[model samples]
Target: MNVLSLRNVTKTYQNHTAVNNISFDVPQGSIFGLLGPNGAGKTSLIRMITMITGVDQGEITLNGKRLNPDMILDIGYLPEERGLYKKMKVGEQLMYLAQLRGLTKQDAKRDIKEWLEKFEASTWWNKNIEELSKGMQQKIQFIATVIHKPKLLILDEPFTGLDPLNTNLIKEEIFKLNENGASIIFSTHRMEQVEEICKDIVLINNGELMLEGEMNAVKQKFKENKYSIEFDGMLPAHLKSDSFSVVEDTQKGLVIQVKPGHDSNEFLQSLIQEGIHINSFQEILPSLNDIFIKNVNNKI
Candidate 1:
């Protein structure tokens, strides 16, 4: 089930097109990655989805209904730009935001306290936003965003100011939210994070949709049939067939590229026959960063 769908969505500003005719679906109860380099229209698309901006053409739907102001109540958005009122007390600010999201005063207080405690931020509840560090403010913002238990959560560069420890904490919370039926749209320039958490992704480049699919399927589609081999002895010349070539050779291992029509099993046997005592051999899969660069560079 898709929690959100964009159909031929296009957004333009004067002579420039921020988001072209791109369409994608965000699956329900899953961590979905919205990825691209800077100026790739990702922010424009997100703004439209959050109702911070409107589309010039095409349609966007949330849970089968047309997106509008009312739907914003069902969505929790944490933008890359921090928007906390600097002088406001953390606890009071969170309570206000939660109330605006339709939570009762009592309910909001309970939820805010629970989230603050979970983040180990209870001690800073009385501190003004400006007094806290950037990472601390980020944690408070995140707590406020989800305090109302929104069904759809959109996070853009959510881990920007967080250290490794805090980043992991938020990541665990994201997974927990998905488990509890919240559909998340996680936007980031960090491909490794997407690989670790997202089941599906939509990548954009220059306002165009470059790719969209399950993470594993996209990786498989772009696979090059390369393998990394580590061995004690040097590879024999006879084992190097016309269909196989060493893309890289180092003290650690050899990165071998297997051409089309080459048999992996036959390649392995040849190496064994040559008396090469293989320590390890494993297929090399392209990372999301690799694919992102390849696609974007190719398009450019």
Candidate 2:
């Protein structure tokens, strides 16, 4: 089921188009990646979804209904740029944001305490936001965003300023939220996280959609029929065949690109004929980072 859908969405400035005739669907209870390079209209689209900016053309639907101001309560957003009252105490600031999201005082306090403890952040409650380090302040802001438990969570560069330990802590919570029925839209330059956490993705560049599909499907669609081989014997300097080409030599193995209409068995036979004792051979699948670079460059 789709929790959010955008149809022919476009956003424009006086003389510039920030988002141009784009469309995509985000499945409910799934972690979806919204990815692109800088100035790729990702931020513009996010602003429109969160109601910070209005769409110039087309429609956005949330939960099968046209989007409106009241629907803001159904979304929890953590922008790339952090915003919190520097002088406000951590607990006070969180409670205020929760209230704005329509949570009652008692429920807000319960959820805040639970989240603070879950993050190992209970001691930070009384400290003013200005007194905390950037990473510490990030924890407070994260707690505030989800305290009301909205159905849709949009996080942009959420791991900035976080150490690996804290990053893992937050990552675990993100999974837990999705498992419990929240849909997520994650935006980041960190391709590894997208590969690790997202079930599907939408890629954009230069105000246009570049790609969209399930994560595994996207990688499979771009597979190059390459293989990596580890052998016991030394590799010949100029190994070549009409059926295959040595793409590169690694520290422990050779990467081969199988020619069209040539199967792995034929490639392996060629290697064995040359006295290369193969220890291991595996098909190489393209990484998400590699695909991202390849597609963006091709579009350019």
Candidate 3:
């Protein structure tokens, strides 16, 4: 079932439409990527989902019901702009935020302690937010965001200030949360990270829905039938055929594009007939980064 659904949702400001007739579903327990280029209305859509702003047209639902103010407690949002109070102590800040999300004082304290220990941040509890580094502060904010154990998490540029170690730490926690029945909407410009973690994705551009589907399926839809073939010997200098064209010469292989009417098998058979010792042959699918660029440029 979908944990969140937007149907022809739109938001506008005077003469400008920030989100125009957008719609998509975020499945329960799935890591979904909400991606778009800057000025593409991603922030506007996020604000509507989080109830920070209302949609100008259409509907949004949570768990099959019309979205209401009460549903806000069920969502844990880590906005791209950090919102921690610099003068506040980490432990107290977390306790406060957790309580606001409907946790009891005692429950908040217990969960806070457990989370701090889990993040290897027990010693940081007593430190003021200003005393920690940017990365350290992010950890504190992350704990606060999840302390109430909300069912839906919306994280925007979550790894911005993190180091490699801390980035992995946060990533592992994200996976753990999704495994424990949380639905995540990960919004970011980092296509590589989305490629690694997201199973489904939706792309928006110029305030309109540009693409949406399972990650692998979307890549398959954009594939250009490019293949990489690794062989033991050098390619024939005069290698020529209407069935395929070599695009590049790699260290141990040549990247070739199979002609529209031909398949990989036909090309492989042609190479075999040419006496080339083949090591490996595989299709090279377009990366999410490449797809993102192409779609935003309206090349899809």
Error of model 2, residue 9, in angstroms:
0.8
- Name the lDDT value of residue 269 in candidate 1: 86
Candidate 3 weakest ten by summed lDDT: 232-241
Question: What is every candidate's alpha-carbon RMSD to the true fold?
Answer: 1.6, 2.1, 1.6
lDDT-better candidate, 1 vs 3: 3
- What does candidate 1's lDDT look like per residue over 176-255, in tens digits? 99899999999999999999989999999999999999999999899998999898877777667788889999789999
| Best of the two (1, 3) by TM-score | 3
Against the correct fold, how does model 2 do in TM-score?
A: 0.93
For the record, the alpha-carbon RMSD of candidate 1 to the native fold, in angstroms, is 1.6
Q: Which consecutive 10 residues in model 1 have the weakest lDDT in total?
A: 233-242
Tens-place lDDT per residue, model 2, 1-300, is: 799999999999999999999999999888999999999999999999999999999999999999999999999999998789999999999999999999999999999999999988899889899998888888888888888888999999999989998899889999998998999999999999999999999999999999999998998899998999999988665556677888998999989889999888987876698888899999989999999999999999
- Candidate 2 Cα errors over 4 Å, as ranges: 234-239, 269-277
Pick by TM-score: 2 or 3, better one: 3
Q: In angstroms, what RMSD does candidate 2 have relative to the true structure?
A: 2.1
Candidate 3's TM-score reads 0.96
